[model samples]
Target: MSDEATGQDPAVEDRFETGPIRPPSEAGSYLLRLTRGCPWNRCRFCRTYKRRKFSLRTVEEIEADIDAMARIRDRLAPAGVAGGPRAAVRRGVVTNDYEWMVANALASGGRTAFLQDADSLVMKPDQVRRVLAHFRERFPEVERITTYARSRTVARLSVDDLRSYGEHGLNRIHIGMETGHDPLLELIKKGATAELHVKAGRKVKEAGLELSEYVIPGLGGREMSEGHALDSARVLNAIDPDFIRLRTLTLGPKIPLWEAFHGPEAVLTRQDDAEIAAEIRRFIEALEGIHSRVVSDHIMNLLGDVEGCLPDGKADLLARCDAFLDLPEGDRRLYQVARRAGLVNGPADLSDPGVRARAEAVLAEVVRTYGPGRIEEACRDMMLRFV
Candidate 1:
């Protein structure tokens, strides 16, 4: 169909793309796809970019996308100023995916942007600098620009290069340091060691960029939970990142980690909610000499409320974990069911009678269907839904 016939702008529509996922905190930010897939897609616990080949978009291509997004902003700005972007969309004024992306970002104040897909820093340093400069020129309102990068990729770049990126427009880098335990890193094929993670994280800090290191609470399974927690804490202590985000592990049959749970030679045992909470407690306790904020922002995290600043909030974070652990067996199970079902945030929610009653009802139904012994399995099934 002709563009005139369909009322579509091919320049804007065909020039840009978005990736599959972004951090939960970036729910409102504009997404700019700099790469097509993960540079290292071999992590067994991750299925995000599997089967897709990684490729970098050129400076010209990314600039084209920035231009398209700016066009979208210009088209939607009047409607947004009159009422709002959402109202415009409801009234059929905002048309096309590109317009929606711009509208969403505008509605959220248009202060942030995230570069995708996996390792954006893998692009040439000069190219990244040019892209960031062009992006700032297009969207000067964006105050924070962030991207996902592998620790190994960050390690490959000199501190000067990262600092230059920061000087351009980039503000933060999020690294998936799933586990700092050597055996678990190898088991999951994370493609980097603990030492490399520390090196990369330190370099990022030295370059004056905010860093968020993600740690999977159950990446080591039951057998190596202690080592996972302790070693991860050791690594974080060395790096002292700006943010320590907890993303609990959730495995399904499609990912290679599933093989560790099934078949004759199975070597790993999945930890239940209680076991994971204990491991998290141990991990939090092991965190020392770092001022990073512990964030439980993801829905997959069972203790979604286990977040606080370090040093001062350290005791409180432990108490929050203990709050869940100290609940009666039945109450703990009820809270687990409620959390997995999205009915409640954490054990603290159960203090309210209404929330407690609702959680009890959910627990009863889960017990009736999955049987009391399999409540953990039911919770695992629920967690898989988020994955």
Candidate 2:
């Protein structure tokens, strides 16, 4: 953490030699930035970690990290030497560790190391496999390796190579399909076509690995709400991934899209609760074939479990949408208030007096602070987290 220990710029806050690191998300598991900032961070919707350059951790550097971990693990063997804990030993591992002991303890625990930055697979297939092999040698117990792969990147990997990775224990790949709408895709400069997304997704399927594709319901906003859903549905209908993650958009400041939205030539867009709901509906309505669960599990999503198997659950999902739309304006606002305040997930029974009162209180305060401005601002911020 000190300057002497890390020759990195004082301005650079968090740097890693290897192992793993990530940004938080509702999706399960931690991210190991394989590349750093996104390969194409110019997308207006994202600003979370785009303030840096993209680079790779050299093979030698990664290997040295593995060695350091191995050495650290050996240094912390039990003090009694002949395979036994001390009679007085209790609680967690002892605090007093020799230099070697510290290394040994660290190495012993280094079983699951995620490749860093964004697209670690950007490296040659053979190189990636060798890295996987090295990981197996240094930390053999690691069974669930993963990476954040760009669809374009995954599309480039031949089926044989992708399958080989699956065999080698790289069990999952996360791709941000964002929205399946080509117009929307172009608006945000996603750098890949909708057809390309389908190809990449199918390749993941062909590779025999779990694929989690993110869908941003509100990316099109009211301007293209129906198109957002219909096109996205068509795309997902084609790919039929194992999981379709519902990422309700949350726009934040520092995102370029915000500026574009307010600019004279604003092609930027966002969806409100009702418009977003309709967008989701159209998306679902367009679905057929390719069994994918419609998930709204993320907190940002209005309906928490609007998720289930396709075909069989399609009508039920539609009925839920009808139920929501039919609610009186006050009732609809009630659900929105409850959702944004985290009082409840989805449109649940606000009939409970205590829950209703709490939601009302939060809404009241929100109204007081930003007045009507809050709604637009909140929508903008939500847009930033799109897919």
Candidate 3:
């Protein structure tokens, strides 16, 4: 029936809450917001939720959202926008604004869900368990439920609390762990020490949770680059996380980390792309016998082909970085601009005539308009798009 006949407000729509940030792997999962913002917002390099205040959604409010999601899923099921309907579903009839989320989830088979905001594990253990239980009860098909967490918080939680979380179907945790060098961690005001990262990582792993620890390659800049690479490897070796994600540091004018780097009382000296790639290579070489997957998936990274598992694919990962570094200076510049502009994936793309032409054209334009000195700067600035 039309809004006029049913006396329903046509403009009113179901509200599905989502946080501002999530891991790259969670792109296809259902975004279930449990918190409003980052509780520890003092990380200088991160500006994800600077403008917003931190708060937790009450258990009642979160449950209301879960109920709303269930209703939306049900409404979209018959329409074949969710739950893998075999028949062709007519899409024109579902006019609600939130139906697109269901449609996207249906495309992926809807088996994973990511809890949102910077850290959802900061909630009370009983509260977290109840929310997880409610979520699993409502959607039994969701096989994996993951969330971002802080190392200090994880360290403080009792083993029983973490195990209970696992029992409630909380499958994974992604911790920043940006740098393991104490000075660098202190410089960034991460509010967690290297020891905390090791302890917390071990605790989570012991709880039978898959841990993804993110380490930033250029976080320590030029002065502490060596320590950043070696010490980070040391920490990762100690924890032996399931995933050792490489997030190459990218700074912008708005980021406090950048301001600090450029300030008179600078804490870090920024490194160029080549230097950062070399830093990554050093980190990879220093890694010893840890079974973790290294992912350089983001565009901000100078090399994209460096993903592989440790103790097995480590040599190939090293060769990928070396190959990029071995490229002729002129070709390297062309490839850097191409990668930053989203024009190519890796050096292999340069073999394609069409791809090479596009990259050369972009390189020529950058050199002509901005001058040779500005090419690197332009590429670095382009990274802001991904962030």
Q: On residues 228-255, what C-alpha lDDT tens digit does candidate 2 reach at each position?
A: 7888888888888877877766655465
lDDT of 3 at 361: 94
| Reference-based lDDT, residue 52, model 2 | 76
Candidate 1 lDDT over 1-387, as tens digits, reads: 112122445463544788988898897788998989998899998888898988989999888888888887777777662354556556776655566667777878889999999999999999999999999998999999999999999999999999999999899999999888999999889999999999999999999999999999988888999999999999999999999999999888898888876678678888888899999999999999999999999999999999999979999999999999999988888889999989888787988999888888988998899998998999999888988
lDDT tens per residue, model 3, 1-387 = 111122222233356677776788987777888899999999999989899999998887887777777777777666665433222223353444344555456557778889988989899888898899999998898999999999988999987898889899999999999988999899899999889999999999998899999999889989999999999999999999999888888888899998767878786788888899899999999899799999877767788888999989999989988888899998889999999988887787898999999999999988988899887788877898887
Each model's lDDT comes to 0.89, 0.65, 0.84
Best by TM-score: 1
Q: Identify the superior model by lDDT, candidate 1 or candidate 3.
A: 1
Model 1: runs farther than 4 Å from truth?
1-15, 81-86
Worst 10 residues of 3 by lDDT: 1-10
TM-score of 3: 0.93
Ranking by lDDT: 1, 3, 2
> What does the lDDT read for residue 301 in candidate 2?
80
Residue-level lDDT for 84 in candidate 3: 30
Which ranges in model 2 have alpha carbons more than 4 Å from their true place? 1-33, 66-115, 371-387
In candidate 2, position 280 carries an lDDT of 76
Can you tell me which runs of candidate 3 are displaced by over 4 Å? 1-13, 82-90
